[model samples]
Target: MLMTERRAVVTGGCKGIGAAIATRLEADGLSVVRADLPAAAGAWRAGGGTAVDVDVSDTRSVDAMIAAAVGLLGGLDVMVNNAGVAEQRARVDAMPDSDWDRVISVNLGGAFRCTRAAFDHLRASGHGAVVSLSSTWGLGGVPGYAAYCASKAGIIGLTRAMAADGGPFNIRVNAVSPGYVANDMGGSLDGLDAEAAARAWAGRDLQASFQPLGRQCDVAEIAAAVSFLVSDQASFVTGTVLPVDGGQSNRLNTGEQQWPAP
Candidate 1:
């Protein structure tokens, strides 16, 4: 089926990568219900897409978001689990339990809630698709950011499990692990000094000078990756965490890519 005729739901579509993905999907002809923080005007700008306020960590909010998407957009053919949070950058020992819980609630818990709520509708789609947002931080090790890394890593496991569960129903579940992008909400970096932020993110020793791509990724690139996965092009793909990060995951000495921010 053409993407325009497909009904899709994209969480966290208010800004950054999520918004980019939503815009691309809409441009491809999909009818998208873009959900994000209440009063997010950017998400609504995705042409014909409808933007709804949704907090994925809450069960009722997620359910309502999905219900509205299905009822208004006609039925869910795609679900993009993009809503997530990053805990304050602190060592595990210094990280407060409250902060850790909050990260889990939004990053891990949010994905679980949204996926669960959309399962039946997606399963009914016959050839539905689910694209989750993950990060290299989820892979491992970032000195000051334990909760964020752990939460993102947990999402990988969750995505795989969902893939297994959705296989019988012909629904595809996959994830995209993106690296540093231009506009990021989770890290609060827009206000930082560019040089300091770059060093903090890339490290003085590793320097990131050798980074094959030589620069941070753009959000639109992430959207293209997601679009390919949702389109018929990736028909055989499922349960895979494809890193849209310009080979950093592969080139970062010993296949290690650290989290962009704490």
Candidate 2:
């Protein structure tokens, strides 16, 4: 099918990576429905796309979002589960139960809700594709991010499971795992004071060295991966977690000395 004829809905499309994905898909000629909190509806409208106020953590909101998207677009071709939350840095023992629940509910549970709500519409389209945002930490592990890691890892598992079931309906499901990307979510350094922030940013440079590419990823780069996965070019791709993490997922931090000199 032609890209221009396609219709898509991107969760958390008000800002950050979600916004980037919405813009990228729109640029590819798809009619996009940007879904985020009710507070963000105006931003979506300003962008000249169909806007649906949705809180993915709530099934009712997800249902309404999908209905609105299908109604407005006439059908659904793509569903991007880009809505997620990050927990404050904490080990499992130190992490609050509330934080864990919130992260899991928004990250993993939200994806499940949106995907389930969009299933019927997607099945009807016969060319449906879903891209869930996972994380490089989900594939591996890192200290001080227990809940966040668990939630993202759950997304990867959910993506594969959905792909297996959705395959019969001619729907393809995939997960895009990204590394550190500059967005509203920022990185672990978020919320630090100027001096501490500077120190953290410098530390990030040391961390980036672990990634063979030696740099942080851009939100648009991640969006481009989503574009390809949902496009016809990836028709045969399904049940896969594609890491857009600049080799971060494949690397092990032996030491700074171990990194090849640029």
| lDDT against the true structure, each candidate | 0.83, 0.88
TM-score of 2: 0.92
Off by over 4 Å in 1: 41-49, 190-208, 254-262
lDDT of candidate 2 over 120-141, digit per residue (tens): 8899999899999999889777
- Scanning candidate 2 in windows of ten residues, the lowest lDDT window is 182-191
Q: Model 1, poorest ten-residue lDDT window?
A: 203-212
Q: Going through the candidates in order, what is the number of backbone clashes in each?
A: 2, 0
Give candidate 2's total backbone clashes: 0
| Residue 147 lDDT in candidate 1 | 84
Give per-residue CA lDDT, model 1, range 116-158, as digits (tens): 9999998888888999999977886889888888888998999
After best superposition, candidate 2 residue 251: deviation in angstroms? 1.5
Find the candidate with the highest TM-score and give its number: 2
